[model samples]
Target: MHATPLTFIGASVSWGKLRSAVTTWQPLGVVSTISVRAPFLNTIRLSSSIHHTEETDVAAIDLDEANLILDILHRFQEELGAISDAGDRLKQSRSPEVDEYRRRLVNVKGELKNAAKSGTLDGVKRPQTELERCFYGPAVQHAAAHFRLRTDAPPSMWLSGLYDPAGDVSYYTHGLRKLVDEGQII
Candidate 1:
């Protein structure tokens, strides 16, 4: 009997393998692989057929895979697309490249969070509020307080939705759940 590979391997590894398969192998310049598992893409393909230079006729995608793609797209929309208007300052500018960078950051955060939740990373949650989206919440006060005590930084700096440069911020970014585990930051 034939077997599906994913039956033995976990979803996290499946995602990684998919990433590697797509990234490591560079295809021809004219070749493109658009994995549009979303049902709405069929509608879009139909509506925008006039603008296309080449015909795109591929086998119908599996519904389960389509649902997964739809879910991830929804998550991305929730996490980034809505907030794209006011953006992540990657290199002091909000360009398309910066937006792609932020999207990749979110993807890494999601994948790592999924893979390590049972052991390595714990007590981690998705960013809910706008401030929490850009700035680490627990680290916010620590960095702000460090700036306050050391530099005598004014309260307005923190109040104005700005980030202060502090070393402890790394601790918050990398090992946030550990902070909660050790009672370091609540």
Candidate 2:
């Protein structure tokens, strides 16, 4: 039996030979280990352990082991003509038409902001009405019909779309870049 040693603060440790050492390791919560072997690559092996309380789960994954298993699996799947990859999944989830609509909404918002800055009531009203008609009206109606989300959903909910992984990655990347630029990250 291969033993993976784990330690807990305040837990008694009799650090010595395995034969003589006493292990008082008790389940802090539900404890489980999952071992995975890749069929395509006999060299690939992975073991993941998860410990959890009623509230939270703590996972311990060896990056090297996990990577080896994933690489093998990916290659096997590719060879076996497995289903679509991540990019395909992303494309399937995001409709180009929906993205176009979102882009138009963003343009409408910009127009509305410009109108407001002009400080003329008529200038604001026309663009505001156009925005409501062209963007929010159809969006709200669609959400209500399909997802049953309220027409009056919060601004944040309206601003955010169904699935935009690229957008999320871009947002995070921009934040990281900003941090680097400000010398907050090294």
Candidate 3:
């Protein structure tokens, strides 16, 4: 008798929801509450009927919102840099922050570097595992949200819509991809 391999499924569903939220949500517009009805196996069902609303078109987001998102991304990048620099300093000597976050950053960086060197960063060759997919889902969504709110275009548009906003998202995504490619959380 041959036994079948049972695959874990919940992570994919969660990832899908997160991905949808990222791709569809607008920065300034409020996202309608999604209600799931009926128990469908391996399917995401929203209770609210999906209908075409007039707000689907991507417009120029306000300057204030764009500036706010840009500020947040810049801050996040600075935090990552501080942590990384502190870790480097610890390796050479020692520091107070090393005891808490710096050391952790060093360890994570090493692990991610190794993972990348081992060719695990190639998305086509080896897809991100369920855990990774779940972890990245939120980061991507948050970045996208920042882009959407900060950008003056529809959510359906890619990062190339607005010049300054697009540049911000590009920088943010570049940093984010570095951490992800290294297999570390941002």
Candidate 4:
């Protein structure tokens, strides 16, 4: 008897997805993975007849659609600060600033509705530095509602929870959580 090797991609949505598939491996089936980051990543691969590629969509997102929504949501920050700031009561009594924010808020809300109708989601790498975290933290908050998920609805944050603002930080939302339990990204 001859042994053949099967390799799994390291960047799958989650290890839970591959748990059952790996258990079915026979002695002759050599399971292998290529990973430099996560030691245990890349352990699941479909055999020649395990499943079709389309099935993987269950773990993936429609980037175009989610990106549109996310993009619009965060754009509200262009004038002064984001709507999260408003929620945080960061908006001052100055009439001009308040009015601008109100105007932008209405605009962004309508746009987000359009985006929800229009589409889904894709993966985003976790921020590693303080500045990166600070910058993306708000985006994470803006996009957090999309995280809980719904049938056929595009995901908002596919990566691990990235924006848990500290009590001392300016914002207060819980932030985005992992879409998959484990193994979504690096």
Highest TM-score against the true fold, candidate: 3
lDDT of 4: 0.28
Clashing pairs in 3: 35-47, 58-154, 60-152, 61-152, 112-182
Model 1 pairs in collision: none
Quick one: how many clashes does candidate 2 have? 0
Positional deviation of residue 155's Cα in model 4 after best superposition, in angstroms: 30
- Clash tally, candidates in order: 0, 0, 5, 1
Cα deviation in Å at residue 182, candidate 4? 2.9
lDDT of 1 at 22: 17
* TM-score of structure candidate 3: 0.29
Give candidate 1's TM-score: 0.21
Q: Write the per-residue lDDT of candidate 3 for residues 34-137, one digit (tens) a residue.
A: 21111111113221212323443322222222222233334434444454454444554444544565344333333223323322111122333332233322
Residue 155 of model 4: what lDDT?
18
Q: State TM-scores per candidate.
A: 0.21, 0.20, 0.29, 0.28
Residue 135 displacement in candidate 1 (angstroms): 28
How do these models rank on lDDT, best leading?
3, 2, 1, 4
The lDDT for every candidate, in the order shown, is: 0.29, 0.29, 0.31, 0.28
Candidate 1 per-residue lDDT, tens place, 77-150, comes to 33332222333323355457654544543443343233223211111332222213222343433443443321
RMSD of each: 18.9, 22.6, 18.4, 16.7
Candidate 3, lDDT over the whole model = 0.31
